[model samples]
Target: MSRAFTFPGQGSQAVGMGRELAEAFAPAREVFQEIDDALEQKLSKLMWEGPQEDLTLTENAQPAIMAVSLAVVRTLEAQGGFKLADKAAFVAGHSLGEYSALAAAGSFTIADTARLLKKRGQAMQRAVPVGQGAMAVLLGLEFDAASEIAKEAAQGEVCEAANDNGGGQVVISGAKAAVERAIEIAKTKGAKRSMLLPVSAPFHCALMKPAAEEMAEALSQVDLKAPAIPLVANVTASRVADPATIRDLLVRQVTGMVRWRESVLYMEAQGVTSYLEIGAGKALAGMIKRIADKEAAIASVGTPADVETILKTL
Candidate 1:
């Protein structure tokens, strides 16, 4: 079966993530060390021994998650003999995890990905003032329906769909007041449940134009190469490999909805029967299984144990 590798985004982070992998494998430890050196800070330390609040910050969480995903990839390379160029058909990721996918596919080095994500996270957090923006999940609703609710609830404020995360789940983000109104409206419109998410910013909306501009400048200076495997971009839900196109898409993604459900469906249409989630949490894998149907195989590889099992499968 053809396989696609995917990565998780922000909410997947947890304290003590990647620590087990680091403790179990020397290669994995080196991944974290390199990321720490690249950013000139103890990111791994913060992730493993988090005062929770600090690790949960957008800046710290972004790079930390990328580090963990890279560490998992490194462990697979070293111990499982799983070469990325040989195993995967394409790579995709949820929101911030897009950087991890690009790094894995050779669009950028791990260190560069780490640094870029640090800047990206900081920029996104600073785009809107604290308490002025918010995000919420509307469960048991179609994406178009949820988006329509957001548009109606906007009432001239900025409310838009942020993530179409399948499994009847869609996330909306924008001004706090508009999101609050959306939650109430979604419930009234036959949504199973709607709850406000405790995020620092209203990500992936027009309000994030400032962050998009910042990323355009940052990405312009960074070294980016075409990936060995095609990338399923978040903004478009389509495969892209040209370096120039990838850079432009990354910029737009800051102010665009993460078309996650459509991304999986696109891969399925292209004959991808297996999806491996190579990151800290099993969130993406779980979502893929729910969205892509039981006929597709899903794997979560984050630790040495997972690598060992995958070695046997290979």
Candidate 2:
């Protein structure tokens, strides 16, 4: 059966995410070590033994999550004998997880991806001053309805839908006042619920234009190659493998809504019935189940034990 490998982005991070994998496998440990060397810091140390506040910072969380995801990929290749180029029909990730997907598909080296993410995190955080921007989840509303609500609530401010995460969940981002207005308008428009997200900045909105510009310059210096397998890009909600296109889309993704639900649907339409989440959490797997229904096969590969368990599938 054709399968797709997906990675989760921020908000899936937790203390001690890949600690077990590192302890149980030499390859996994090597992955962390390489990332540490690339970033010239012991990010794994912070991830394993977090102050919580620092680890949760966007700059730190982005690369840390990619490190775990790449470690999972290394384990699957070394121990599980599942070559990503051979098994997965497509690869995708949410937001920063897109870096992980690119790394897995061979568009970027693991070390390079780590460094890029660190820069990405910092760029995103510094794009808008804290409290000037905000994001919120509006549940029980279709994207069309949510878009209308966001536009209506904007009132000439910068409010826009950020993530369409499927299952009636849509995240909106922009100026704090506009986000607050959108929340109110969403509730009045019959949204199931609306609450401000505890995010440092309003990502994937017009306010992130500065961040997108930052990424464009940063990405230009990075070595990008065509992925061994196709990558379902976040911005376009379509599969793209060309290196130039990948680089361009990555910059655009900073201000583009994460069409996760649509990406999964696109993959499903392409005959990918099985989805493997190769990362710290089972979040993408859960989202796939919700988006694709019970018939879709889902798996999570976070540790060496999970690698061994998934060997039979290959």
User: Highest lDDT: which candidate?
Assistant: 1
| Candidate 2: tens digits of C-alpha lDDT, residues 13-91 | 8899889999988888999999999999999999999978888899999999999999989988888665789888999
Best by TM-score: 1
Backbone clash total, candidate 1: 0
Local accuracy of candidate 1 as per-residue lDDT tens digits, 1-314 = 78899999998788999999999999999999999999999999999998899999999999999999999888888876657978888899999999999999999999999999999999999899999999999999999899999999999999999999998899999999999999999988999999999799999999999999999999999999999899999999999999999999999999999999999999999999999999888989978987896899899988778888876765
Candidate 2 differs from the real structure by a C-alpha RMSD in angstroms, to one decimal, of 1.0
Model 1 pairs in collision: none
lDDT (Cα atoms) of all candidates against the true structure: 0.93, 0.91
Q: In model 2, which residue pairs have backbone atoms overlapping below 3 Å?
A: none
Evaluated at residue 164, the lDDT of candidate 2 is 92
In candidate 1, how many Å is residue 80 off? 2.6
